[model samples]
Target: MSEALAVVETAGTDTTVPAVSGARQFWRRLRAQRAALVAAAVVALLVLVALAAPLLTALEGQDPTTYHPALIDSARGGVPLGSFGGVSAEHWLGVEPQTGRDMFARLVYGARVSLGVSLGATVVQVAVGIAMGVAAGLGNRWVDLVLSRITDIFVSMPLMIMALALLAIVPNTFPRPVLVALIIALVAGWSTMAKMVRAQTLTLKNLDYVAAARLSGWKTWRIAVRELLPGLAAPGITYAALLIPSNISAEAALSFLGVGVKPPTPSWGQMLTSADVWYQAAPQYLLLPAAALFVTVFALTVLGDGVRVALDPRAASRLRVGTGRRRENRARAAVPENALPEKALPVKSLPEKEGPA
Candidate 1:
């Protein structure tokens, strides 16, 4: 019996339960944050719209690039001629001023451009940051110093100024959208992520598991990949989430400044630029794109904050669960002090039961 017990114990020690993937765990934690969940849903919807932009444009049979001077209300300064203040069944949102293009079609297609640039840039940024950060954290002291200095240089430099200089110098032969994304990623992507990853790696390196891996003669790269990287995922991803909105806003600002995607590409920023002159006549033109940008950035920011809070051990306790307010109210109402006295007290049995028996 003792031998069997010993064998069982050895098996238990040798075969550890498979740990959950970082992505899976992060998702679980994110789901705990209600605001994050809602924000994620909104983000997902936006992504879906962006992905299906072409199909939706086709279904509506609206050409974003084609001019429709006939549809415009010249009386109202190029607002779409319609029943409800330039809005009609034919032209859902309205038409543009000078171009007279379908506003709705442009708006839908513009989502693709904005989301594509932001998402692509974010991916590049996070990947580069994680790689450099891990190397710096795990490498020798000299390596760490060099990488840290490089990171410091980037941190000190204003990203917009650098980007403007680069944009001006770089030839226009490059695809505008791709160039914009690449520029943002290369210029501003890695700094924050790298710092976070390095901090996490430094903390993880001293942990017992990491030390055990080192003692077992595990290769440094293997230890970094298998042990340290998993620990960095939560913080890295949370930071990446936050950085996405920043990238999106930056892209918009650049596009507004005429350094982004060229005309007819249907970017939200380009639309905003076009609407500036026609604000009084066709206010919807300005309002629609601006509102969309605001909502998108706001949602992403909130979601990112929620993710950060969810991933933080200290913040976990503060995360609200269920329909928070309602749940709290119900719990408080059901407490002993709030309940009726009779219901709160335990029932007592009468001794007269013996006489009945």
Candidate 2:
């Protein structure tokens, strides 16, 4: 009996469970959230649309800059003619009020500018933030103080006002989208990321592995690159995901205020700027770009939240909230009974027939 029990215990111990990698686990958790998956799909579609702007415009046989005067009603303040803002076979999404530019063409092309600036700005912000954050976290007392104070100063400044002031002074000779992205990055984009990184670094630097690395005579740069950076990636990626929508909104606000991308380039915000005056005459003009912005922002925000939850172990419970029962059932079915803990094993009752006999 003792030998049999030992054999059973060894069998249980010998069963090898396949290890799931961190990336795979994260992907699984993210995929489990239906809303996040849908949002991801929507974001992907928008990105595809943005990237294929020229192809889409070419297929529509309309250039963003070309005007179709006949499609507009000059007699009535250049309101688009026909029903639904002049939407027809030739112009799939109708034409602009005064200019008669193809709405579809402008919208698809505008996506390129909006997404380009937002994504570019995000990259700049994240790069600068990590550099500043690591420097502050790893440096001595005075270094931390200087960087932290600078970060606080940037955080406190009025973002919109500073962006406006800076953009207004910059020469338009520079590539508009790149200039806008850089200005956005400079004014207010990086402070949050830096702060988060600094806090995380301060905590991570005290860990045993980091100390071990230090004792191993590793340089500060090497420790930061090899030790701290991997630890920082999760939060950095999560924060970066959240930052994209904010940057998109900022870009739109700047453009709507006439300080962003100029005309002929066709940004969503620039479209909204023109759309504002035409709301009474042509609601589609306002509604199209407004809806596009709302959908993109909403989708991005949802996806970002999903990423945050997926990356955080503490938040794992939140993802399981609605699907708890199904997940539990699936887990119970998938896990072999023998692989369960010894404490969970069934206890066999001794035979009592011999005593009665």
Instruction: Give the number of the best model, judged by lDDT.
Output: 2
Backbone collisions counted per model: 0, 0
**Model 2 regions lying over 4 Å from their true place:** 1-17, 316-357
- What's model 2's TM-score? 0.87
Instruction: Write the residue-wise lDDT of candidate 1 on 44-145 in tens digits.
Output: 999998888888878877868999888777776566666433566656787777667888888888888999999999999999999989999999999999
Assess candidate 1 and give its TM-score to the true structure.
0.82
The C-alpha stretches of model 1 lying farther than 4 A from their native spots are 1-29, 73-79, 83-86, 316-330, 337-357
RMSD of 1: 8.4
Tell me the lDDT of candidate 1.
0.83
Residue 289 lDDT (model 1): 94
